[model samples]
Target chain A: MSHDHDHDDHHHHHDNHFSPMEARVRALETILTQKGLIDPKAIDAIVETYETKIGPRNGARVVAKAWAEPDFADWLKHDATAAIASLGYTGRQGEHMRAVFNDAETHNLVVCTLCSCYPWSVLGLPPVWYKAPAYRSRAVIDPRGVLAEFGVTLPEGRKIRVWDSTAELRYLVVPERPAGTDGLDQEALADLVTRDAMIGTGLALEPEAEA
Target chain B: MSRCETLADSPGLPVSAEGEPVFAEPWQAQAFAMTVRLHEQGVFTWAQWAEVLSREVHRPGRAVDGADYFDCWVTALSSLLSERGVASEAEQSALSDRWARAAEATPHGMPILLDNAG
Candidate 1:
């Protein structure tokens, strides 16, 4: 299915700024469009999809929700597809969902060996390393080493579970809620959930880290 | 904890229950969208594009790095454009050189202004 056409208050900010990568993108866009190879409008829609529609914010919300309610967390673990869709984050490429939880004894990490199939509705897009051949290869072969590379040091004796996602089933890691968040609400908790945490590369941020 | 259960994609109009390929870099997304839009516009059929892309990735002397997926995609598109007569190889190569020179000459934090940019 094509992207939904809600086109809400998406900010079309024009700061006349383009990073080196952005400049290269602009050059490609111009070159391709001028040669009648690509339509500017199609690029606009695709850009908007990743830029605003699907992103870490969506997954953060889901993580926060899981932390806020044990019943909801159970729903996420038992029936992630329905649990996630119930939150209104459904669309193309994000219909089937599976969420793995972090506990004192088990850690979950996601990787797609064949291709970078991700939960676009929640995580938006994966980080570069997730799609790298090394990551896809090593996540299964050497999960602990890969985690260490990301500065994540799991406790000794803790078993790491890696999820190899495919085009059929997708995964979102429900990171453990950080300590010292006693009075924090769902929104505040969401703020503490980083993309890396949801991907099992990092932990829920320390409370003091919240700005 | 173990790997999540693998499921087969639902048969349908390509929407399926699962997600599509996610782009890590913005350039990858742009390259992907450009290819998709071009296909939709009939610049070349998906079958033709797929065939050329398979050839490009499998071409002689290509790097074995998997991180080059989008890079390979872009190169394949360039090859397709040249092969289909929509753009010339020399012209695209010249354009690429022009940008590299302009980018090198531009100062930090300023726009890369090409003299011939339209």
Candidate 2:
């Protein structure tokens, strides 16, 4: 989080202190800067891209919109890329998108076995576990076991569909809207959409979760 | 995008199967972004970066059998920096040791503070 000439940036990260990983990165950044090999502003800009432009919140907005509008839900089911782009979530790693809905009869899981291909525009960066070898391999070979490990136990009658994303396509799971959300607005509904839910590993927050 | 260029260049590096760029850990993402940005900024060509990474992978004393591509990337970057005189081996390891000591001495779940001045 180094900003070469920005004292404000320093003050901001110094709130308590930086994390161990952040400290390590900072050490490298400080040295690279001294050698004129890197510009702190450039690093800041990259960080900003994910922090602001890309995040799970974008996908939540799409999910919320879909939930509030049945027609948009149909649109998401049919042409997710166009529908998502309509919300300005178009960019690298999200050019081609698909929305898979989770239901009582069926559950969907996403994985990229060859490599870690994710919807960066919508989900930001993939989590460490998502990219770990164990998750990547298990998500395909033993999907039910994987979901079980995540504490997601589908119904005995339910079938699980594992989507192995290639380099050109990405998938997002639209978790079923929980009960009692009937009166919630789109923003509030979006608030219930957890990043894990979109990744097909966790459920959305219950309507009363905020309370 | 050319960002895919570097990812594709490395033999064992993760290539986009059908998903966007992913960094498993924060450091991985940082390293991934740094590699791409540096390439974009003309610090190194994708080919050069890719070559250095392959060399680092096969380099002795490093975990060659491990699947940590970013570790290879970090070593490669350090080597390139030292070779180019941007920084030396002594300086790099010195800083890393300081961070390691700070991390080990810090209480569990506490923020690590390097005792550099102390």
Candidate 3:
């Protein structure tokens, strides 16, 4: 098979060479700096929040709280945005996100088939693969097969439903509360709640079993 | 977070003579990057992405509002890149200036210019 597929003439190489988004960002920075849109302190605040106090760790807290308090979990299921903000873990994409609780019978997985629409406020930006054509295409058709690629194996008889997220609604998967987490404090429970569990790819880490 | 607000208020148009508008907004790139990263991580297959993206590109009214295949391509880029914090405004400006300088330095007829909007 001759795989020298070079139909480059048909391509709009200009757009590809220098990313438009990068341009926009650069232009915005120039204008902002010129117009004094950025306060020196604002940059500090943004960097500090992202580096020190945000991301999966905060998401873990949300998960831990959900695990410990039934009422909170109920609220999360009903109104994820309010529930998240209530815990002071709110951000841009998470403003109006929804949480899908996965279980043994019905396992929910998320993908932005068209684009990477995620609950960034809670989970931060998704890792690169979430946006790839492979994941978007395969997740809907063969979730179990895709999960296996991520090293996830579901027990037999579990039905998986893939949810497509949009700008209006983002998502988090409230993984089934881990075993040995019974009566654990929020902090301890948070430790068990990992980014993978929040994404619904893997279960929350439970305490090790006795020898 | 509020970087978008700054860009929204700026001026001087979107792109240069040779520069093409890939994404309508900066966040779109971040979104696009996030999606691409997820795919790389093997959360799903490229086939799935192709199917969904084709549908998105062909969605009703998208074609009529001057939206064509290229727009879909750009939209795809926007969605993926937006999630990755692809680039910032100042950085893009520097790159554009560099490209312009390179274009100017290139011998006549050696460099081709496409996507000239005006």
Error of 2 at A109 (Å): 0.4
* TM-score, cand. 3 vs. native: 0.51
Give lDDT tens digits, candidate 1, residues B1-99. Answer: 000110111111111133544455556677767766776677887668777777767777766655455666777777888888877767776666565
Identify the runs in model 2 with alpha carbons over 4 angstroms from their true place. Answer: A1-55, A114-116, B1-29, B32-118
Query: What value does DockQ give for candidate 2?
Result: 0.08
**Model 1, position A202: C-alpha lDDT score:** 84
Best by DockQ: 1
Per-prediction TM-score: 0.53, 0.53, 0.51
Clashing pairs in 2: A117-B19, A118-B20, A166-B17, A166-B18, A167-B17, A167-B18, A168-B18
Winner on lDDT (1 vs 3): 1
lDDT of 3 by residue, A115-146 (tens): 32456557754655565568777887888998
The local lDDT score (0 to 100) that residue B66 gets in candidate 1 is 54
Best prediction by lDDT = 2
Give each candidate's interface RMSD in Å. Answer: 11.3, 10.9, 14.2
Query: Which of candidates 2 and 3 is the stronger one according to lDDT?
Result: 2
